[model samples]
Target: MVAFDRPHGMTPPQAQWELPFFNQHHHTLALGLADWAGAQRVDESDDRRACREWVHKLGEAGWLRYCVPAAHGGALDKLDSRALVILRETLAFHSPLADFAFAMQGLGSGSITLGGSDAQREQRLRAVANGAQIAAFALSEPEAGSDVAGMKTSARQADGGWVLDGSKTWISNGGLADFYVVFAKTTPDAGARGISAFVVPADAPGLDTSEHIDVMAPHPLATLKFTNCRVGADALVGTVDGGFKLAMQTLDIFRASVAAAALGMARRAFAEAVAHARQRKMFGQHLADFQLTQARLGEMSALIDAAAMLTYRAAWMRDESPTQGAGTPAYTAAAAAAKLTATENAQRVIDMAVQMFGGRGVRVGEVVEHLYRDIRSLRIYEGASEVQLLILGKAALKT
Candidate 1:
């Protein structure tokens, strides 16, 4: 039995989240979420069904309320970045699918909260906050994965409305979401400045989602095609040429939480490694007795510490950073650093934990095995590690 009180040198690995960066509310939120997540035995068999169920469960528990503001179905007066970080971190530790479900709700409706008209906020964000609706963020297209400016998806003015015609692939909650926050090119000649955002219901007349995507760690992904999908003038979100900035703003807030989720997965793997090392023995001594094992454990602990601190700093700074409701240079760079470091470190840490677990680690249904697969996508999604490096390098050059 491990002492959670952290008396003297008896601190568990999870005690790291209790660092000075967090306040009473943050601590309370983490402890409460830990209890809730621990009690949940997840079944992620049907990616679509599992995502829907997770969303339902999260909504029922009132945790989904944290995704929006209090005035329109939320627990806080504003979108609390720190609270979001804690929630994602805890949920990811238990079930990555759960984290994905919870995250898309926030990501899908984030633009509305930041830039939506009052009516749009009520139309989407309120429903999203209550778990009455599932939300999807649709920004990536077949020709435009990392390069947002290269998107071929366009929304043209017609009949006092707009007609969206193109495809968006690799969309989270694509087939499962009740509504999608879609970014389209309104000015075909203006490049990135030409983009616009819209709130498209899943049942929209011209939308099709027959194409399903199977990923290594699946949680409801698909390709969306809009064949002359028309929407009224009211469906537009934010300014006509401001979708890129809106999307960036939305991502900037959640990017640090991605790091936090990675941190949580890394923490779980570290705990399992510690438990296994202490119990397993070799050459008439426990595995923890070996010098090399001790060295590896020490190194793992150090990596976790570095990642946690960076993630925490990034999250808090995001909450505090001032900007034009777009994004801050300081926060943007910090978020990129945190995401880059945490996801890459999680991959390494989980790999080491699997190695320590020996044959059991690679076997199907093993915790470490799931973690290995789960961590791989984080490095690729949100923004690839290479893209993060470019962001950091560019930020450095400007500074």
Candidate 2:
């Protein structure tokens, strides 16, 4: 891991945390995290190794506590969306991989926090909180990316246990996780309703996680093949046929956090561009002195602010609004809007930053160049831009 440098004393803006959407604790959390994240450096030469190091550091620093509840060694009584947004945004600003490591800890085990039995909670939650074990959420298959119901993985009752058979692709922490909350269809013809969730240990027989996927970014992903992978009855999570709701609930909590991650990347790009402008000389003057440069910077700042507002609003709605939560049209629409705008706007902002850097922008190790690749996948994951558009369109029609 090479040392990360911040030229021109550039840091993510903290003024945004004072918005009404955040409380004193949120501000404190952001400030503390910014200081911590800015000082840490991991050799990212190997993505997997670097990810493990990040997780270990985050867990040791008590940052992973935010990923769970106080009962399970978390920092709060419940999962707080605003807090999650703050954490993801701050981490992503410094290193997108750090944000990824932090987010997956919560997301991979979210279902258990919401629906697991007392035994399951006791066994996994604390370990996850302390980094004794890693976790993964396995739901998407080769045929099912956003369409959850299209998954072909199936589970059946066998010899007083459950057997899972099928393949799960695009699984984050795939080969590295200690356990996976795997979703498979228990009722083959029931579409979404036929599904169920189970906790499958990574060492379980008949499970394959050797197929790693290389993406444009540094995220660790893999394809999992389970052929008659059996687990004890105690491994079942939630009620039968309840996996769909459980999965949706898990995603709901993290959806806005995704937008926050995008917001962080955008904020970083903006900071980089501004610092470059002030120092870069062109046409017998600094880049910042040009009217055209100022206008472009103005556009980038506005885009970041817009995305920030929507992302914060969505997180606030989830954490504070009585009418919020999974299946609530209002929160769903807000999250969809936030995710759509933050991701799309971040892409544009980063692209603009790259343009401003000219030939230097695409250089291998340049911050803007790295950010250019890091910001692309956010637009496609968790729910694509097109999906968010359809959701917004449907919400408008209903209104």
Candidate 3:
């Protein structure tokens, strides 16, 4: 059977998976966060309340400080992609909610970091990094999730401001965020080019999130209704009629981070499977004694490593690329490739781990069971696996 003997000194699992693309600084962060995450377990009994508490805890512990730039009181000079990768992978290894809280702080306010005016960044980015406020990305709607241009929501210019009229659903941190980066149509017939982004405070009049959305994996989500919701001219984020581009650009960086999150879940499942294989017995012999079990374990290990390599490579390339350049063709393709391979592979790895656990795996609260639920949504969100394929295909054909 495959075996791993850890070194005498402390070794975070993140360190063991390190690539040459990352430096000692990355490994150090992984070790620190791995220890921190193992200690802070949030209660999921109340998903909404628990998410709030988790965000506060993560901020208080300083992990959320990497979400923005040093100009706005962040730890890093800018949003470091590799650092984001390590943080998400380590946190997800311990708790998916924790990773979610951390990721939203980055993604929800990502457009602001990339294109916000100086005052806008000063107003929101620092608070986000400090976790003084929760952030939400409000892009998907009832009918416009994958087909963004199909959105019916409109932001009409009114009284030196814009009045938002429509709804957004399936939004993470929906009912709980301090602010949302909302995307809407500014010009009715201009297609993607007419869309614009706005920073709408949760307290904006007419904004409603009374409907709590339930999913297979428990988390805080809701449908937001913005009937005549209005905000000042200063609330516009990035360029007017540039919302679609901004949304895509924001997702580009976080896409690889999503892959990192999946990798963590995959790693945890592998560890559980390995431990079980050594202890489980059948036919008067250990489960590891069976050739079938060995083969299953082998495949699981290979897939996990392959996913890690892809995820790390993608993250490294994105970080190496210039900032404010997330929409560049090369970076977009790399991000798409990593997200596709890692999330899909993670699902397979987690499923195999559940199979190895036999009947115990399907039990409601088993780690594998929870991971199984947690990983399914990854393949569907942040650009689905099919979407990633089209992106890569377009790039390949062009080359």
Best lDDT among the predictions, by candidate number? 2
User: How high a TM-score does candidate 2 get?
Assistant: 0.98
Per-model RMSD to reference = 3.8, 1.1, 3.8
Question: lDDT per prediction?
Answer: 0.84, 0.91, 0.86
Q: Please count the clashing residue pairs in each candidate, in the order shown.
A: 0, 2, 0
Q: Write the per-residue lDDT of candidate 2 for residues 1-399, one digit (tens) a residue.
A: 252466747788899999999999999998998888778878887889888888899899989999889998999999999999999988888888888999999999999999999999999999888888888999889999889999999999988999999999999999989999999999999999999999999999889999999998878899999998989999899999999999988988999999999999999999999999999998899999999999999999999899889889989998888877555999999999999999999999999999999999999888889899999999888889999999999999999
Highest TM-score: which candidate?
2
Q: In model 2, what are the clashing residue pairs, if there are any?
A: 1-42, 1-43
* lDDT for each residue of candidate 1 in 1-399, tens digit (9 for 90 to 100): 110111223212357557876788888877777766655655676778878888888988889999999988998898888898889887777678888989999998898898999998887777887788999999998989989999999998899988999999999998888889999999988989999999898999899987999987776889999999998898899889899999988888899889988987887788878888988988898999998899999988888888888888887786664651226787788889999999999999999999999999999777778889888989877789999999999999997
Model 2, residue 74: distance off in Å is: 0.4
TM-score of each: 0.94, 0.98, 0.95
User: Per-residue CA lDDT of candidate 3, range 1-399, in tens?
Assistant: 001112123223754546797988887887777666655656776778878887888888888888988999798888888899999887777678778889999999899999899999999988887789999999999999899998989999899999999999999999899999999999989989999999999999979988889999888899999999999999999899999988987898799999999998898888888878888988999988999989998998888788888788777887775752355788888888889999999999999999999999999878888899999999999899999999999999999
lDDT score for residue 136 of model 2? 94
Model 1 clash number? 0
How much lDDT does candidate 1 score?
0.84
